[model samples]
Target: MPSTEITDDTFIRRYADDIAYVAQQPPATDLATLAAQLDTVAPRYEAAGITGHEDLETASLHLDEALRATGTDRDAFLRRAHNLLRPLVADMTQEYRLAAGD
Candidate 1:
């Protein structure tokens, strides 16, 4: 039988790249804009089978806080967001490579 898998390109794959790009934005980049962008992503994540451990939500939360924060506090929030997101980029890239090999 042919494979029944839904090969529909996953949101996680797209999301990984999106967050990676956002993470690389300069400190002057607008936090509110990125927060809005990430909000648009949340609805799709659950349906895409993104698990709780992925914790993309926390990254968004940090961005939201960063927008409200200032000085060292804002920097801290952005740093946390970057730390949270960059690993997902690597993890999703690895998963994509493995799936391609399969």
Candidate 2:
């Protein structure tokens, strides 16, 4: 959670936006790109010191499940991923926005 201040450069904002954007698209629209983006989350999370954030962990589980599925299975998982992650992303974005004084 944010306190009174946070930098706009924080990694979670971009990561949240990217995940939201990808999740909103039709699953088959770009599975390869989605997978590529999901692959970056771990290293980025480690760099961002995002451990113990429940929202992030939940969102990551959804993304990871989607990453491991294929074809129609992947599509199903992606749809659920969007549903599961949307609120987590929104909460994170709102915290960052408030901290940034937006």
- Report each candidate's C-alpha RMSD, comma-separated, in the order given: 13.9, 11.7
- Per-candidate local distance difference test: 0.53, 0.46
Model 1 clash pairs are none
Q: What lDDT tens digits, residue by residue, belong to model 1 across residues 21-71?
A: 434432223456555556554444445455433456787798788778878
> TM-score for model 2?
0.43
Which is the leading candidate under lDDT?
1
Q: What residue pairs clash in candidate 2, if any at all?
A: none
Best by TM-score: 1
How accurate locally is residue 38 in candidate 1, as Cα lDDT from 0 to 100? 61
Q: What TM-score, computed on C-alpha atoms, does each candidate reach?
A: 0.55, 0.43
Model 2 misplaced stretches (Cα beyond 4 Å): 1-53
Residue 59 error, candidate 2, Å: 2.2
| Weakest ten-residue segment in model 2 by summed lDDT | 3-12
